[model samples]
Target: MDGFDNLSASEKAEATELQRMIAVEQQKAQFQAQVHSFTDVCWDKCVDTPGSKLDYRTETCLVSCVERFIDTTLSITNRFTQMVQKGTQ
Candidate 1:
């Protein structure tokens, strides 16, 4: 018998929905981890030392670093996607 055979239609639907929600949450967690990693790397490269207040120059460098990191990530992802698509074709 199937795992869900004992469930009513409504119950099965609810279980499926819950599974989808769990998958979504997992993806969100993974994305958060990637962002944290990016921030750590960018911080080391952009900031000279910790200060009580962020000076304008340091603030600008941090912002630019993050933007470039994001752009690089997107470019790599797009290239990988294209490669996968080409391989499948």
Candidate 2:
């Protein structure tokens, strides 16, 4: 690919915006994948069988399970970020 320096101002802005859009899309896709994985795992743990609708207890369990998954994900991510910062320093 050609050097970004050769791009005109408007072209540079357009490329930057496109890159931002791509990043947003990637984040969306990653979040969706994570949710799917979490749902599958929580389903196996909290669900006894497929029903027309979930019972209150099962519903609560699923919600808590998903929240726990989110909390763990955030905690791990924060730990990794901290480790990276420490390494850089």
Candidate 3:
């Protein structure tokens, strides 16, 4: 904050935007990691063998399981966000 105060308006704006961009990238990386984890878990649950191509049933199971996992994660995230907001208020 002390260093930020010495920055010119343009420099401050640029710095803020850079910080926002970095936050967005970090979020994207976290989401990618979640997706990877979801897929790995679903693959283990749905896949019996590593064939050249997945059969229809296995593919469907993987999709359904991943969707449910993402949905559950979003629901929990939303609940936690609400709780944090309520606490702050």
Candidate 4:
């Protein structure tokens, strides 16, 4: 904090912008991590192999994979809530 206070106006501004950039990069990294996790799960469920390019069947499977994963997440969440409520009562 004291070091930041010693910074010139321009340096402070640059630091602020750099902080913002770092925050954005952190968010991007988190998003990428989520995408990688989803891709890993979905790829196993969908993609059999990679040859030259993605085939129509694989593409369709990928789409279904994401949809089903989301659906499964929601379903589990709902059921978990219901189970908790039932237990509480």
lDDT of 4 by residue, 1-89 (tens): 54689889999999999999999999999878867887999888877877889999999989988888778878998999999999999
Q: Cα miss at 49, model 4 (Å)?
A: 4.7
Worst 10 residues of 1 by lDDT: 38-47
* Stretches of model 4 off by over 4 angstroms after superposition: 1-3, 49-57, 68-89
In model 4, state the lDDT of residue 6.
Answer: 85
Which residue pairs show collisions in model 3? none
Per-residue CA lDDT of model 1 for 1-89, tens digit only, reads 54888899999999899999999999999999988987898789878989899889988888998888889989999999999999999
lDDT of each: 0.91, 0.95, 0.93, 0.88
lDDT of 4 at 18: 94
**How many backbone clashes can be found in candidate 2?**
0
Pairwise lDDT winner, candidates 1 and 2: 2
**What 10-residue stretch in candidate 2 is worst by lDDT?**
1-10
TM-score of every prediction relative to native? 0.79, 0.90, 0.87, 0.55
The residue pairs in collision within model 4 are: none
Give the true-structure RMSD of model 1: 2.5
Better of 1 and 4 by TM-score: 1
- Tens digit of per-residue lDDT, candidate 3, span 1-89: 44789899999999999999999999999989998899789988999998999999999999899999989998999999999999999
Query: Which TM-score value belongs to model 4?
Result: 0.55
The sequence of per-residue lDDT tens digits that candidate 2 reaches over residues 2-81 is: 46799999999999899999999999999999989998999999999889999999999999999999999999999999
Candidate 3 lDDT score at position 12 = 92
Off by over 4 Å in 1: 1-8
